[model samples]
Target: MKRRGVPPALLDAFLVLVALIDTWANVGFDRGAPLGCALLASFALVLRRHLPLTTFLLTLPTALVTDAVFATLVALYTLSSLNRHRVLLGICALTYAVIDFLPWPWSNLRATELAGTRNVVHILYSVASAAAPVFLGQLVQARRELSLRLSEITEARENERLLTAQSVLAKERAQLAREMHDVVSHQVSLIAVQAGALQVGSGDPETKSAAATIRRLSVQTLDELRHMVSVLRASGSRPTELTPQPSLADLQRLVDGSGIEAELKTDLPGDLPPATQRAVYRTVQEALTNVRKHAPGARAIVAIHHMNGTIGLTVTNTAPTQAPLPLPGAHHGLVGLRQRAELLGGSITSGPTSDGGYELHLELPIGTT
Candidate 1:
């Protein structure tokens, strides 16, 4: 985790206070040029961040006139940390060293005379002092750069991980779509073809009607399967054409083709929305389907009406006249219907009635539909 440091304002104040103390110790409050330059250098530290070069120039006069060197060293460090030009930093450091090494009365001194061992030692110490702050500042700048690069690297890795996961999911969906096309569609097509043949071959009126009904249902199932396969192949990468759905207008046809005695009594507004109409139609279809499979020979009533500000849909069936035969079923029709209703901001409640029958209720707000 990254650690927080002192606030910028507070740190700047602390630096100025330290500079003032250094000024007082080396160049006391004497009425002279040395004291004035020292005071200017100490306060110039305030401009180090915004005007680092200017701050260094202001502090140079203090280094030449007095022994108070803390503010000058700080100004040099600040310039080094903020600037990328090495030549400018080198010139500043060398100037600082030379200024601090020469004594007060050096007008008569020559380079050959300064070749003494004591003079050389003092010059070396001054150079080292000037170089210390530059090195520390460079280290700080490098650390800040490294932190930024690490954050960028972490973000790139997260994006790569998400892309890899999506690729795997797309592959799985493609495989499923292939299986549906190759196996399920082929089987359903054969059912439709056989039902067609039976309808034509049968001579009895009732048998022919039954065969026709079977063929119609088989063809409908094939259409839905084809659409589902196309959707799986798309893998949601782009928009796929929506299959035509049954609205309120198709409700009567659905009940007639259900192969069950179902009555659809609707007292609804003429301006019902497509989504609400679809939901109601689907709920009634599922209810009648259940009555046919689980409650054979039972009569069903589908009632849809507007009550208060809500639209109410109810499907109820009487008790079966005979025991139903065992049949394979996925039992997902009602669950799917309830989920669809909920998606449309509606609710569904379904259970057995006290008269030994099944009933499903759906309620939806007119405004939300």
Candidate 2:
């Protein structure tokens, strides 16, 4: 309803200026009575925006008296622009037309005194004068409404696009998380099992200690992996409860399942925090999986050591005796393991060794549970 940027008072003043110019050009200043009436009609335009109907009614008498065409046109334009009532506008236009064309008090002549052709010409001109501004004002109002509707539609479509993009991104992330859970969890669990077997069968005290550390780490990794999977699954609807997660104790079963020659050495507290345990497990699991894939028939060594407020793990494999199996892989195991370590305030590094093998190392801080 409110006109933006254009002050009502300023617009009214502009309308007054238009009315004054129109009156000056049509009704000369030399004619005192007519000029005075024209001035009165022009001055009424100052309130056109605020009180358009009232201004139009006030100027109607002056328009009839002085025949000030511009003042009447200004009032009609103001009424049409406001677009309050079509019936009222039509009535006002009709009244002005009748008064302007008919031979009345202004012409000091009766209607019968005018010639038929002259009366017809005067009627047509008066009708056009009354109708032209109203038509233009209505056209302007329609265009403004159309522009506002288009703007709203454009904004709605943009918001819809933004929401759709966010939904697609969320779905992609959930899918990636699910894939990682399925592929890497199995490989990591196998590493834990292998480490557990080494701890139970090895004769050397150092070797048994290392095996124990690997088993514990693998079990913790399985637990965290399950938790991550649960989070992914919950991202969608149809939420389901997760099964009990693995712990340090489950590493032996994992090692027994994997057919690989591996050794583990560890000097860590039995009551290690869950986060550190999970980080160590994932590191060892990812390293062993990489060894199996890249260095078939290679012997792997896993060493775990606890220092001041931190735990360190190193997994290294000797050169393979045979070519690795040609297996399709997503190639995201290492990246996922690294991400896991970082999430737990830890770091992991891996590279090919000088001996044509591979080695992975991890260091995790033991933050408060």
Candidate 3:
């Protein structure tokens, strides 16, 4: 875009006029001196915006006195629009004014005119020079501030875009988890119902044994599926009509149902919230399930401690003699457990113990339900 202020052509024309006037009015062997000075001043003015400091220095001498009015104006405008150092600019202006009026032979003017028309002209020149530089400096500073603000706005928009991307990814993950739960639960529920029916009937030895195995597998799969759904549904509000979760009070039933004997000890606070109790229960449930699947016939230990607005649950089981069976899909139970813990500012840690045993530990803030 074309910039504001005087155009180059107009400025060039003004310089030509000033040069011609200086050369014609003065009678001397060095007739082109004024013309040369005016042209140089105009050239400096034109390039002032790009190199402000140099332009200010270039115009400081002759321009301070006689015919370099345009040059002085240009230097001031350049200094103000570019350099931020006002004190430096002021010092330069004062120096130029002092030198312009000094009673020196090379200066080609006398002290007699110091308070005359010459003085008026010098005063006007000083004011214009200082004012233009200051004005341009303010404009430049405002432009810089505006640029900074624009950069901040752009950064904020980029951050918002990233957050939106993350939230979308989280939702997609939740949807996939929900779909998996549906597929697995449907098959497992059908198997469980059929097995239950068969067990009530024919007592053929093979059929009875096959039915019992089916019932066990089906029940286990259903429980795992339910846990998966619970984890997936962690984002929304708590389920209003959800069945009460088993806590320490029902720890015995959990161990008995899993067919893995759990030696349990509880020092739990009576005032523990339903959510804390439930988290403890689920940790134990998952721990026992892992024991059955990966540590078959191994004894398990469960412990609960409540203190200082925190509830800590631990479950450890001896390792199985056989190799662990690989499970399909992501570990939704652990994912849900972590998500639940994070929601309540809690944590869970699980790993193989030192003596060929596996342990699960969970901590939940009290009154966080």
Which candidate should be chosen as best, given lDDT against the real structure?
1
User: How many collisions between residues are there in candidate 2?
Assistant: 9
lDDT accuracy of residue 120 in candidate 3: 85
Q: In model 3, how many backbone clashes occur?
A: 6
Candidates arranged by TM-score, highest first: 1, 2, 3
Tens-place lDDT digits, model 2, residues 1-369: 445698767877887888788777888788877788788888988877788888888788667766566777888887898875889889989988887876547557765757688777888998998899889889888888888998899999999998888788768768878787878898888899899888889999988876886787788779878877777756655566766544455454544434468887877776877766766776676677778777888998888887888878898889999998898899999899888888888888888899988888888887635
The reply for model 2, stretches above 4 Å from the true place, is 1-12, 25-37, 103-109, 113-115, 193-203, 215-369
Model 2 lDDT, full chain set: 0.79
Angstrom error of the Cα, residue 64, model 3: value is 22
lDDT tens per residue, model 3, 1-369: 223798866875675456445434532225365455555655665566577778767666445434445465556665766676878778766666665445444556655666878678878875665565566767887897788898899999999998888778669768877787778788789889999889779689777776876698789778767876776666443552455556668877777667555688888866667777777778788777778777766888888887888888888888676666776646687778878888888999988889989888888888797
Q: What ranking of all candidate models by lDDT puts the best one first?
A: 1, 2, 3
What are the models' TM-scores?
Answer: 0.79, 0.56, 0.43
